[model samples]
Target: MDNFWFNQSDYEYEVVEPCTYQNNHSVELLVGQYVHSIICILGFVGNSLVIVTYAFYKRTKSMTDVYLLNVAIADLLFVVSLPIIVYNKLSSWSMGPVACKLLHGSYSVNLYSGMLLLACISTDRYIAIVQARRSFRLRSLPRSRLICAIVWTFAFLLSVPTFYFYNWYEPLHTQDVYMYDGHEKNLTTPQFVCEFRFTNNSTAWTTKVAVPSTQLAVGFFLPLLIMTVCYTAIIVKLLSVRNFQRHKAVRVVMAVVVVFVACHLPYNIVLFYDTVIMFQHQMCEASDALQVAKTVTQTIAYLHCCLNPVLYAFVGVKFRNHFRSIIQDLWCLGKRYIAPRRFSRVASEVFVSTRRSVDGSSDNGSSLTM
Candidate 1:
């Protein structure tokens, strides 16, 4: 392994170090990669299942359903970018400039989109529960469509900076000139680094303190506050009402809130730590410690993309039913030729009967049944 690359500002070049891992770094990196792989695979499968089910079984024309669909779509798009992250971990970026920008920018899209959808879901439930009758007239299909458009637009705009930051640069060894591209120029060393130079005269306070603090306030902290207040009000109103369970609307809201908290809260806490670290000049005494922290923070953040799908499918009874139906249909397709017609008929009958029993006699009962 080569020595560490030193940043030289005199010459616009950087020293490139050969990629090799020490034992400690190797273990930490391996663990992170393993977790990343699990998240990518499971997130993809789960989100894909939700998308298929939402498209086929629960084709209801409701605003809440539309928001759920958006959630699934965002997760799918985010997880698709995981392969690029995996490659970045195992080796130096082999993909060209365009690919790097697109791939890295996707991480922001998933984060913002998922959070926006959560906010939408919370607002939806708040309206549906707090002013049940009034909300029916207020939250219409067109409004939902408009909100979704705004959400996507906002996400795309926020992610533009990510693409802007991506660049390929070589390292500089001495404060001297060198050949770069096709011309003789003042260049750094040949070691390439993917850098995002946020500010020309930015301090640790700005990068670590200001940016992340704002993100925490707007992204995680504010959303959490709104969700808590809305859900609290909802729960109180639900308790006061005699037939809240009969409507099952309250139950659905509870499930959504619970899952959102479970899947996302940990990552936000990790982000808080990262924000603090971002501002600090020295992360730790040892290089290994810094690397370990990076691995952990990245892993926690990345896991959110995977968790969104699983939570949606498991939290809502309707989502689970829709998912099961798709799975059954896929399974039957493979075995239809070999299986007897009598067996298939019996299975179908049993499934319908069991579903009716579980779903209850009425939609109201079915809402909270699962």
Candidate 2:
């Protein structure tokens, strides 16, 4: 029997000659089709709103703004790939090998990039708050943009293995057996699956262990370590402060760290376990359980993209005010185009008043600023 391990971003792994257990295909379908669809929708909307708000309403005045914009772009690209991935899961890979490599590689790239960007954000915060005197010169906008470029380049390098190894291949599976004329014959079916396909057995170790270890280290563990250290120091600094907003700042930092861990930890744990099991023989039951866990946890990790805007952008008072202003402007424009001529005047007056209120406000308690 051959057992299959399915990872949404890492692709699938096939283990041959495993003890047979009933594999539930419905779980994959349910999560990939429905749960992933919901995530895709929410992620698209949330990331898009962040991008639009940043592009139109807010200027990239600080390093945090630049990092947030890049994070939104990375997440947006990740969510955009979901529909294609869902289609591939529901049916077969009709999009061909080029599309296969590009889609999977891009997914891996964005996954790594998003996590790395979060780490960058955490480090920036630590510098801004914990090392305030040096932050002025260190956190310049040009330097931040350069750092973002370096991050993207490094993420692409991390994803090179996926691009090289992933391809659409048809694997033969034993469907059934029939006895005819005292002879037993096996029936086999070919199913096209998008997965990492090595050229030979010599590359198995590299693909199975090294590649995944790199992903786990750079994509999850590295970010987690950076965030943990940076946020810890930041909280300590906040505790020593006399500012009233210190408590609020501490809560926001805790929320960011908690959400990051809650979203990615389960999936990374399962991934690490799966990576380890690749080297050893495992029972079919264990592999089956791992598959189900991976499917569910991977989707949970994807939910982070949807919450990024809420946690990083909308949490800031300035961003919320800007977003509100955008909405008001849209509403006034709609009224001018669609409402009665008498109502247009009222809409214009309302829009002007709202703009004045937003522009005149002195509320500078932005979560990122702290």
Candidate 3:
């Protein structure tokens, strides 16, 4: 039988008995249901706010704004797939093969695009700050949009493997032996699982190693390297400047890099180890440990989606002000719709003053304080 999950290493061991390993069904269920539920809800809300603030409220969009808006869109797409994933883990993929491929393909596409857009954001910042006058034209709105188009196209291309390989599979497990008339028959039940299924054993290396390695190299390491270099230069530049916000800007950049590493590094490391072990035979205990680690670390990595808006957008003073304005406007609109007379004059005055302050303090450059 083919591997049941994408993260499972390519190895087979003799099954001497059923229930030989410790059961962690309850723990898996808890994490799959509760943890993922919370991530889905928070990621949805946070990314939605970012998208709304950038797409509707902002009259002028900077290069960074364009990159961030795409990042948020990628994140929202990924967040939408969480419920299906969680449900699949707990029960079965009732959605069939086409839905399975679409969901998994979309997940991979967004995962790659989100990370790439973040790298683009860093590159744009580097151009805008470190090489400002020399590269002004490079950071134009039209160019940024063109770059975003390329990112989406490239991401879709990268996800072609997932789209081709992922499908709903029902693997049969032998339960017991039964005597029927003169012969004994093995009774088995089928459990549905959505995973990568290769055409033949010859493609095991491609499915087990090449696919995941590509994901790691392109999705994590490349972007991490780009961000590290860009931010390091940015920090050095900030130190040479006499601006009061330089220190705060440096802090924000550091936080962004640190959080990215903290959230993704552990999972990538685990996945790397898992990939390496695919070549060697392993005991059941070792395999079990690796599988557990992959699940837990993967969940932790998923939290990064929820944290993106906070790290990228909400950290900016101007973005926060814009977000506040959106909230205030929604509040005022709700009050007016519910009870027009109850919409206090003082509330209107406060709202007007807030908008004035926001508009006055905002710059034509990136909403990011840097």
Candidate 4:
């Protein structure tokens, strides 16, 4: 590893070329921020609602529904960390040391959990539908619960090393400088940096990179391949049997695959990039291009937190109906509150009373009685 001087303290500061004072704002950043915030809120709310509504409102205890519940739970847990990314975008990691580790750990855990749960979903659907003759007693609630427990536990276990390694560092890099007094002085300042540092030992490599890479292979890619094969077989079977149930079932399974690919791809890409690609480049000098790449990739990764809810809309008819009802109810509530009959009646009664009194007629409000 190349030795580079960096501020090891909690806070560092540096003086850079000051920008000319201007009130003009950046539209791109603003738009990105808005999109990120909205997605975070939607993911949080949508996933949570899925869990709550399914758990309470719906009573059928199918293995498929249980896995869907697990997915929602995983997604919600993942989205819980998005606010930190949102804040990281707006500023830097103002969150203290504890929060930094927990957020990163939770994020990683849920990322793994989501993929595992999706795999479970795909596998369960395939078994229930394709291998219908087999005793799918494994798909019972107890078995489903056990699988969910194992999936979550494994996700947490996989994320443990990340939790241990990641930390909040205040980085200060040397910069060439010129002072106002015609003298040059290199200045140091605190930049809230989020990075992982493991002891320079052999175990660090295996623990950090090799193990995680293996987990990615086992947890993500293997299941994805299995799903592809299962879906292919299922599709061939469904095509042979021309019936509505087979078509609907195939649609549901396909929707799961599409959702899994769309939402989880960015997160897996981020993991691959950070663990494999960036490992070699971490020691390289930080250039604007590298910084931009990191920012864009991270943004894409965080965008996954929002995609699950959109997937729910596409895949789950129940979710679409639920969402539509929620929107309609909210709209009705807004109209009822904003233009209530009580306020309008009060104003009209006041005007009618005033008019009747001004006419010097009967003080009783006869004309406006109702």
Best by lDDT: 2
Q: Write the per-residue lDDT of candidate 1 for residues 198-280, one digit (tens) a residue.
A: 54555434444654565567667767787888878777877787784534656665766776666566666766766655535
Candidate 2: residue 113 lDDT (0-100): 91
Q: How does each model score on TM-score?
A: 0.74, 0.85, 0.87, 0.68
Give, for candidate 4, the lowest lDDT window spanning 10 residues: 361-370
TM-score of 4: 0.68
Model 1 misplacement above 4 A: 1-24, 172-191, 202-211, 242-267, 273-280, 283-291, 337-370
For all candidates in order, the CA lDDT equals: 0.65, 0.84, 0.84, 0.63
Model 4 alpha-carbon drift over 4 Å, by segment? 1-32, 172-189, 201-204, 248-252, 262-370
The count of residue-pair clashes in candidate 2 stands at 0
**Alpha carbon deviation, residue 202, candidate 3 (Å):** 1.4
| Per-residue lDDT of model 4, residues 248-278, tens digit only | 7667667657766664565566667667654
Clashing pairs in 2: none
What would the TM-score be for candidate 3 when compared with the true structure?
0.87
* Ranking of models by lDDT: 2, 3, 1, 4
Please report the TM-score between candidate 2 and the true structure.
Answer: 0.85
